[model samples]
Target: MVLNLGGFKFEWKQTSEIAIETDFGINSQERIANFEALLSAKLGSQSINLNGQTLPFAQDGQEALKPLYALAELRQSLPLVTGLGKYLGRFAIEKISENRSVFAPNGAFFTQTFSLTLRRDYDADIA
Candidate 1:
């Protein structure tokens, strides 16, 4: 649906996945939880496709790419939100990948795909 990174916003493509991860450790004596940190978090890639050469569609591609580039440039932790302003967590952009295909007559790309990965940043007091 909608995704925002700092000041950029876009309507995401139809296919996307979100994942969260956690961990637990065992002790030799009691086989009980032995780790001070019991929870972990990770985010799945957000993918989008830009296609067509029409007025709005071509412009949408540029708009989507702008935020992705901004995330990569900004190394500091930033807020990530999804589902109509529900706060997911603070995170840093870990990686980004782009695929381009089907060049136009003028050598402009007619189809583009992008994938973005974000990693959670634990608070100082929590971790």
Candidate 2:
């Protein structure tokens, strides 16, 4: 599967999971026997977990995470690309955590695993 966050293309690892959510409201009013209102569409945000993956090449640890760090700092909407399709809108970077597994000769992290969370933008289109 291919994933594109804004313009950054990520290399997928062997293991990954995609979660999709939909919300609805059930009405218990005495007038109606049973009624359900669609609170939201399948347009709900998707949470993806890219567990245990190496960071892209860079001069050092900081450099490798520079782009990702920038995205985290922006905290703005971004275009999200999924294998099934593509979504254009705001995507907020929820989190970015790293785990160092290997070190370079200069004592910099050569191999590191990073986790990221992105939230989709909500608008009237879903309603």
Candidate 3:
């Protein structure tokens, strides 16, 4: 399915790939992890805030990333990616039974197709 708001669009499918996957289907932490990883890889060699602490990278990049970091955090807490069109007036997402997704925003068409099965991180568990 595809829903287009403004110019941005989101198309969901039923693929066996999930770069941003979550078992709870509602846990916010997984989203946070995804965002943090993206920022780290995409914004490498730059200084930005992660969670609370400031992260200074070892590369050059756009100055606006600082703000993007904040936005990412906020979005992590209360995700609006699905409805970005409503707030920013441009975006879309098709709710399907797909484990994978392709996010094309602005001039960057990011595609992440992951073939993964579910396995609880028992090692990270702490009681």
- In terms of TM-score, the best-performing candidate is 1
* Model 1 TM-score relative to the real fold: 0.61
lDDT of 2: 0.58
lDDT of 3 by residue, 1-55 (tens): 1322222223343122233332332222336436622222221111111111111
After superposition of all CA atoms, the RMSD between model 1 and the true structure is 7.2
For candidate 1, the per-residue lDDT at 89 reads 64
How high is the lDDT of residue 102 in model 2? 67
The sequence of per-residue lDDT tens digits that candidate 2 reaches over residues 8-117 is 66655522444443333333334456665434334334444444455435423345656767877877767677656766455677887777756668776657766676
Task: Kindly indicate the candidate among 2 and 3 with the higher TM-score.
Answer: 2
Give the lDDT of residue 49 in candidate 2: 49
Question: Predictions ranked by TM-score, top down?
Answer: 1, 2, 3
| Position 80, candidate 3: lDDT | 25
Q: Residue 106's C-alpha lDDT in candidate 3?
A: 47
> Candidate 1's error at 75, in angstroms?
0.5
